[model samples]
Target: MVGQPSAYIIKKLIHDVETVVGKVLEDRSTEAAFWHPDRRARR
Candidate 1:
């Protein structure tokens, strides 16, 4: 948005984003695994 971000800030931002995305996906998959019998078959 402004000037170039610092390396440490960039790394922290990326790490935070990945952690959020990974947790969301993990939770969704766990729900699907528990509720969807054909999930693996469809995959």
Candidate 2:
């Protein structure tokens, strides 16, 4: 019974970490897309 709760908590923590990492990667890619040299040159 105790182990079941711990397993659930661990799964939730892993999910939260994955969500944050995905958001960070998405933000970085967006910034790069807008700030790349070729894109900047067109402005």
Candidate 3:
């Protein structure tokens, strides 16, 4: 029973980390696109 709770906690932590990393990558990509010369020239 104890192992089940620990396993659940670990899974949740892993999921949270993955979510954060995905968000960071998405934000970086958006920033890169905005600063890209072709995109900037259109503005």
Using lDDT, give the best candidate's number: 3
Cα displacement (angstroms), candidate 1, residue 13, comes to 0.1
C-alpha positional error of residue 10 in candidate 3 after TM-score superposition, expressed in Å: 0.2
lDDT of 3 by residue, 1-43 (tens): 5759988899899999989876776679776465565764676
The CA root-mean-square deviation of candidate 3, after full C-alpha superposition on the true structure, stands at 6.8
Per-model TM values vs. the true structure? 0.55, 0.60, 0.60
Q: Residue 5's C-alpha lDDT in candidate 1? A: 63
Q: Residue 40: error of model 2 in Å? A: 19
lDDT of 1 by residue, 1-43 (tens): 3465687788889999989876776779876566665874587
Q: Write the per-residue lDDT of candidate 2 for residues 1-43, one digit (tens) a residue.
A: 5759988899899999989876776679766555565764676
Tell me model 2's lDDT, rounded to 2 decimals: 0.75
- Root-mean-square deviation (CA) per prediction: 5.9, 7.2, 6.8
Model 2 deviation from the true structure expressed as Cα RMSD, one decimal place: 7.2
The residue pairs found clashing in candidate 3 are none
Clashes of 2: 0
